[model samples]
Target chain A: MTEEIIIAGFGGQGVLSMGKILAYSGIMQDEEVSWMPSYGPEMRGGTANVMVILSSERISSPYLKVFDTAIILNQQSLDKFQDSVKPGGVLLYDPNGITIHPTRTDIEIFQIEGNKLAVDMGNAKISNMIVLGAFLKIKPIVKLDNVIAGLKKSLPDRYHHLIPLNREAITKGMNNLKPFLVAEMILK
Target chain B: MAELKLMKGNEALAEATIRAGADAYFGYPITPQTEVIEYLMEQQPEKRTGMIVLQAESELAAINMVYGAASTGKKVMTSSSSPGISLKQEGISYMAGAELPGVIVNVVRGGPGLGTIQPSQADYFQSVKGGGHGDYKLYVLAPASVQEMSDFVEDAFDIAFKYRAPVLILSDGIIGQMMEKVYLKDQKPRMTNDEIIEKYGNWATTGKKGRERNIITSLDLQSEKMEKRVHRLMKKYKQMEAEDLRFEKIACDDADYLIVAYGSSARISQKAVELARKKGIKVGLLRPITLFPFPKKALFDLANQVKGILSVELNAGQMVEDVRLSVEHKVPVEHFGRTGGIIHTPEEILEALEQKIINNGSIRHHKTRESSIL
Candidate 1:
């Protein structure tokens, strides 16, 4: 199985790190993974993004036009990627700073309350982890244990103390996911 | 045994340099490619393997430093993006003329002047067609993956030292910034002074022990002597073209149309090949792994079979000229590319191949399009 994903948000929101951890998790499962981030001056604050491909086979191209899953964290990211999701693909997002919601009906739109969960966890930095948790719940692309292990491995030793909290935030994030259903489509 | 680890292409190249026993890295910081030096500084191979990592104040200083280090017959290296690489071309030409061995990693960004710090293969002409002064060629290797990014460090050094010439790891910002699984090579110890003298004492600046001083210079007032040196360099390039030319043929067997690309464009073109074949177009991909020793013979042979040929790149039809020259206009040669740091999608490539090459095969001539659409 191959899953092409884009996780996009503000520069300091750990968007690239989240993708890196997910890619590392894929490696732990003996899969091929590639993580490509939007770098340069814009990455400092102007809506950073990363393209991650986890494949059981060889990955072809790091630059992907359509994503099987788009983990949009802010209104800007959602607006940029809502229509770019593939048909029957999943669109996971954080309802933290979002104003306009996704408009697509062909793809499943799932929202994780990352900001509230991170606040509950008493660590604002784990917001991306929560969104990752919601992504795992939908795809199960990698196991929960592997994801936790991957989070620990991806972080440096100095930041090791935050792993447990991040793990908990991911679980909370998985539980808080709100699936945009047919009712919402009919309402629209 | 080297373990498989996940790494960005830039970091992987740094680690590879350490493992390859690179004697020194003299480089300047550049966007989209700065991670090479950053990783080297962080790893501190000087402590681990006695390799040197020095950040020069400018690209000019860096390549000159590399030249100085390489004169001692050590495995020296330098890395920079497109514009910085342009500054290093003089030093590279010096290294080539002096017949010193070194590796220069060009993690290419968009170019012309101070272009954007995004991935682009616009440096194809500068890299493969000799950006530096004088008629010289660098053994240009293009890596499409993080593993190759790391692995080619060793290959570059091996080829560089073997022929006493410079080798270039001609990569782009896409491969430089991307992260993927890489199986690192086992660490090689840097050569000792005694070993260096043994291997290259004939020409290396090894204190001139037990013999008259061996002077290294790129100058010869006599046109006859200079002509001989130029011929020698050309001969070496001919040998490399004959023996070291490398390419990857992707599903070319029984195909009617061929898409030639390198680096990131090659990877994307592979996806385009799959999409085109799915739509009943018999297309395959030809990936040039070594850009300088360019697989012209292979391209010519393939041109005889394929009904049409399309060269895809992140620049405006640079390698397409080489492709056109390779087949000698036997088959229709066309180029589809996006420049100024823009990358083309597989669907766009497929559409171009279908509309511009495969379906329009009767137009038995060369054509090109500047990518204006997103």
Candidate 2:
């Protein structure tokens, strides 16, 4: 099975790093993966996005017309990529700044309160991990142990001590997810 | 087994540089390829393997530095993009004329001038057609994936030293910027100056010791002497064409149509080939890994089998010229390209294959439906 995902948010929100971590987790689980970031104009605090694919077989196109999952963090990304989520796919977003809620009835939509949770945890940088935690809780593509291992592998040695804090944020985000009004399916 | 790590194509190339036992890398920073020098600087190969990694003032200085290191019979490399590579033409021509061995990488961006920093294959004509002025041919290797970006570094050095000529790893921006899993080469110690002199010093510019002065010059004042040097260069290029051609044919054994592509275009065309196969169109892909060798024999053989061919690239049809030359117009060779850093999707290529090559005549009936009804 192949899972094509798009992680989009503000540039400094660790959008690219989030995708990189998931790709590393795929490697940790012995799966093939690819990570492609939108590296042109969005690199300077604008809306940033990255395409990530994890598959049991070799991945062909790193750029996809439609994605199985879209983790959106801002209103711009929500407006841009709301229609790009495939039917019966998952669209996870944090409701920190998104004004217009997604209205599609074909896919599963979840509003994850990662920003509030990060503020509550007194660390604002691990919000991406919280969204990642929500993604893992909703669709268990990779194990939590593998994700921790991926963090250990991806993070530099100086950032090693922050792994436990990031793990806590992920657990908090996983526990505090709010699904849409009508849920037809819960992938797990 | 070698360790597998996730790396960008440029980063993998840099890591592979240290692992390949190359003695020196002199590079200038350019978009989509700055990561190569960044990784090399971070690694500090000077401390690890006694290799030198110096950031030059410009691409010209970098290439000339590569030439100087290579003149001493040391394995050397430099990386750049399309515009920067243009500035390196003079140095490249000199090194090639002098027959120095080195590797040059062009993570090509779109161009006729200072083009976009995004991925583009517009350098196809410039690279395979000999960008520098001379009768010299540089072995050009096109890498489609990040893994090849890592592995081809070794192959480029080996081929360069074997023929005592410059080799180019011609990759586009997509492969350079995109990240993928790659297996790195095993670390090998950098060759000392004495080792280089003893092993490859026959024509090298190492000090003339225990022998007459070994001159490494490309200048011949007399026209007749220059013609003789040209003949030797031509002869060596001919030998390389005979032995070093490499191409990959996928699903072409029993196919009706063929898609000729290299590097990133090849990757997309492979997907298109599969999609066409599912539709029972019998399409296939022919990817040329070595562009200079041109894979003329393989294309000619396939031309005898396939009804038509579609050459897909990210440029405005450069390699298509080589394709037509290879098949000698045996089949209808069509070109599909997106210039100025525009990359066509797989669906677009598949549509072109269907419209321009497959279903236009052989796969579709051109007879009037009304006449058949009448």
Q: Which candidate number has the best lDDT? A: 1
Question: Judged by DockQ, which candidate is best?
Answer: 1
Model 2 docking grade: medium
lDDT per residue, candidate 2, B296-351, as tens digits? Answer: 99999998888889999998888999999999866788899888777787878999
Candidate 1 per-residue C-alpha lDDT over A6-109 given as tens digits, one digit per residue, 9 for 90 to 100: 99999999899999999999988999999988997768779999999999999888888999999988888889888889999999888777767777879998
What is the number of backbone collisions in each predicted candidate, taken in the order shown?
0, 0
Query: How much is the lDDT of residue A81 in candidate 1?
Result: 88
Instruction: Give the poorly placed runs of model 2, Cα more than 4 Å off.
Output: A181-188, B197-201, B361-374
Q: Indicate the worst ten consecutive residues by lDDT in candidate 2 chain B.
A: B362-371
Model 1 stretches with alpha carbons more than 4 Å out: A182-188, B364-374
lDDT of 1: 0.89
lDDT of 2 by residue, A1-188 (tens): 78899999999998999999999999999999898887776878889999899999977667665889999999999999998899999999999986677888999899898888888889888899999999999989998889999999999999999999988978987898889744343322
Q: Record all residue pairs in model 1 with backbone atoms less than 3 Å apart, i.e. clashing.
A: none
